[model samples]
Target: MIVSIKADIFNNDKNSSDLSDLMHFFKKGRHRMNLRKIDDFSAFENSQWKQTLSRSDIDFLKEGMTIVDKKEIIVSESPSDSEFRIKEAYCYLQQPLSIVVENYEYEPVFINCIFRNFGNELITAKDRHWLKFENGGGASDNTIKGMIKELFNDTVFTKSKEKYLRCYIIKDSDREYCTINQDDTISIKKLPEAKFRFLKDMQIPYHILYKREKENYMPDSVYNNFLQTANKNDKKKEFSRIYLEFNAHQKDFFDIEKGFSHKGRLKNRKSLQADVQTLFEKLKDGKDLNDRQYTLIGSGLPFPNLKSDFSEKFNAVNRNDLEKRIEHQPLLRSEVNPADQNERNEFEHIINEIKYLL
Candidate 1:
């Protein structure tokens, strides 16, 4: 299997034009260097500069250079494991070089700086999993400091330029993926085989599944935030931001691991109904809430047609109206399973809990 890997290069802590020109120069040589090598070279270069250039100007030059080190990374290419490395360097030379070019100065302004490899793994190819990359074999960015840390290392200098870096993924056609439809509905593709089974086994309430083919690309800023909102305890090192939609009688379904892994009790209905009551109280207290919050709390509740008296009495408003009322009054919906007595009993227990809390 051959999986396409996409990536981008980001340079921070310097001006765009300066960084671009420097990158052009670096590209002229197919070079690789480790952190210590770059640092040693830089130290030697700085010693030479100390004897030749003014201290203030050298400090300014140091401010202009961005440094990086090389590393090796391993990846799976499907049925086989592969490794790659990235060599990068950080340098601090501008004025001295500019002066040297003018012929009056024998001083070298720019230094080759620090270079290292940032590691990235090729997890899969053509939808098939393969062996994991062994450590210390290739150059790459595997750590947070190398991966995206530079972009945030300096706020005033690098934040806006982040737009230059592009991130891409090659997904297989068979699995479900998230898409924003033109009509503003978040849609999903063909869901994973286990997600459906888990939903059924757990009695998750989803009323429909539709093939979503809409294209409404969201800006990276918004999308990036959404990706960052995953559960804190989740081992995010292995997961990317991938979501799919499933229509239960409720609106707005979003969960990725549920599709990938067997999430048996993650969406247990009784707990969800309790969440609905909690959301309502928050609204009653005049809190500002979003559609997702409402949907999350509501998804756990029993809908309008349960024969249970508690459900019939509490489910007074429809979904749309409930959303409107979320400003001041949140509706109560129970997660009721008409066919499963165990589910019904658990739901009743939740209802009693809600009543006691009220």
Candidate 2:
């Protein structure tokens, strides 16, 4: 799939030009030529019959592109996560590249790395060993890829080519080896365009060449689709179910108008208030306040506990206050209490008033 763009130079059709000029052109500009083929979409955009091959048979069109200019790399560490930037991308011809990176403690750690190729001299590390270096990542592709991910929260891509291939097997994390694939050592050339493309795809605008850059954050159209989920949720709604139980048998009869003793009533009300307060206090203490609801002839405080539409809205005390303030309240609902009869209406109304005291 990745072939030279100049293959059409060998097309032997009648409409093609002579081959001599093609050879001369190659000789003159071979080193500077960019080997990208026509993109699929652009190739299909032309007329069906007028064909793209130049009138010359032996000659071909040279793609207009620039070989990336080399730049000096400023390799340094930063104080915080936001400051680190990816400064290099190394390509490997072999399946796995062994890397020894310095950890945060300055200790060297090793990992095996593989990558995903994004055509036109760019690739991103696909998988890496679990162990990592601390300073950022261990030296090698791990550190570079980690820095890139930290900066853009996206994958990193860098330039590479066949001629840049390394001809050796690394025997250790230090890059030591006895097997040699190439007899000569070659210097690496940094490709800024590849870095540019990577950053651009990561949703970063403005230039990275300067500090204190000003740019607005624009979410991709794909990210915009997330709001579709918001309509299904309502923050103002309370839980529809109530975890409640009340016992008419346990009701305290307080006849204050007849000058009757209210000590028993006060004691019962205080115990109930204490229990309710404990629930709220537990929540404030970051503890769960999940208590079972009892019904009918239960001995404990016989009051209905309101359950919210969601567990996270577990402010039972506040919800009770709001419900009591409302003029219209839902009718009492109890599994054991007969829904077919309103015999317990006066009792339920008195018990529900406990919300006003809490």
Question: Which predicted model would earn the best TM-score?
Answer: 1
Q: Estimate each model's TM-score.
A: 0.17, 0.14
Cα lDDT tens digits, model 2, 213-249, are 0000001121122233324442111110111111110
Best candidate, lDDT:
1
**In candidate 1, what are the lDDT values of residues 197-287, reduced to their tens digit?**
4324433222121211001111123223434764564433112222112221112222221321224333333344443333223332345
Off by over 4 Å in 1: 1-20, 23-39, 43-57, 64-166, 169-249, 254-358
lDDT of 2: 0.23
Residue-level error in angstroms, candidate 2, position 157: 27
Instruction: Enumerate clash totals for all models, in the order shown.
Output: 34, 13
Provide the lDDT at 244 for model 2. 14
Model 2, position 51: C-alpha lDDT score: 61
